[model samples]
Target: MPSQQDDADPVDTSVAHPARRYDYLLGGKDNFEADRESARLIAERMPTIRLVAQENRWFLHRVVRFLAERGIRQFLDIGTGIPTSPNTHQIAQDVDPTARIVYVDNDPLVLAHARALLTGDPLGDTAYLQADLREPRKILDDPQLRQVLDFSEPVGLLLIAVLHFIRDDDDPKQIVDTLVSALPEGSFVAATHVTLEYMSPEQFAAVRARAEHQSAVRSGAELTALFEHPRLQVVEPGAQSVSRWWPDEAPQPRPSIEDVACNGILARVGPRSA
Candidate 1:
């Protein structure tokens, strides 16, 4: 995993950034004209992108709550975007006031906003790390992460809606494997990824071309394969649309597959086979 000099990187507001564009799509005010323009171009092709972003956020909420209820407390959430309401730490700490979270993101703006807004519960703990997800070893070895979490215990490794930004050439699978390898048995890896499987050929091509960040949208099988490391086993409900995965309360009118284009899974690491 290549490491960019986090300190040397400057915030370029002139160019649309993935985190800022996502914040804008989610109706947050931390975006600039460049981000809005980028979002506008993408929304022009798939108008429901905002809805898709919301669905992915909801998935994060549900998954965090589920993991907390299951007694998994420590969280290493990489690619954490701008701090939004009911953020990952908020949801996890709500379930268990002592839950610990380490929020990691490469964007300096995200780091700035997160450090200011992502306060932890008095009973719990939270820390922010400005780093790239590609360097799993660096993240795992960070002193801040070590300070907040106990690697010996079960942890919830969150990769929600972030992996799509990593191109296939980046070896995203190796990144995942490296992160998972550092986690102890009983730890859970939950991830949500954007997919092109549901889109028409023309729509898929158009969205990819307009996307500000290079994306590697995968098929269901390919996405599922990301969690197929020997030490990890995918949990029930497998990989499916976020809205369709264990809904808390059904909407009056259920959302169709077209309503959400992301697939997610919660996989657990267990004892190595004899």
Candidate 2:
């Protein structure tokens, strides 16, 4: 099992956290009333919100497997929500027991559960860091991250279902650039974000107004624009609803984009510009 670096702040259950709320949506018992309340409100606006969460999770599993199959043995999984089975490490290590993974999250509760449940294959390594995505430098510079991941090799950077939590003022583009820039050439970045583009005008306005306190949903175009870096190239299929990213691997009769309302992208990092 891996050790967890503690966050100074105690867990505040009064306010709803995206991670806890996500766990709740996934039918996990690790959430509090506030998280359930927040998810309930979101579900009221979008009846298929739970299915959206499931599809996003499945997307993460598929992307990890894809990266692992392509010889990506190390991963930096940020915004790792509460311990869900078949986690990033589980899927990657399944493909190769030697795969190393580093999980980062701001929530102390996530850290607590992750330390206990996120133990990867003994042949590999796993470490948990309590950190915020807004501070990419801190995550990149963390001693645990450096110890677990080797910069010389390609890494799969997973931002699954978390980027929407970052508000516009947070400069998400710059944050993503800083992290992607630090990776060596051949590294891959995969991200999934909530979007309202598939919704009707009426539902979009209603959900947007109510969900503003929790997330900053971006359309597929805006989400794609976040990876506008000289060394990054979008993978084939470009930006698509999470359910549609790899429909062949997904369950038959895939849900409509309108129900998923989320976009995912995978970009590979090329050699640094001289």
Give one digit per residue, the lDDT tens place, for model 1 in 1-274: 1122365668999998889999999999999999999889878888789988888888898889889999998999999899999899899989999999999998988877886898889899988888899888989998878988999999999999899888888899999989988889999999999876677888877877755356788766787888889999898789988878877533435466676778888999987567
lDDT of 2 by residue, 20-99 (tens): 99999999999999999888888889999999999999999889999999999999999999989989999999999999
Off by over 4 Å in 2: 1-4
Misplaced by over 4 Å in model 1 are 1-9, 211-213, 249-252
The best candidate in terms of TM-score: 2
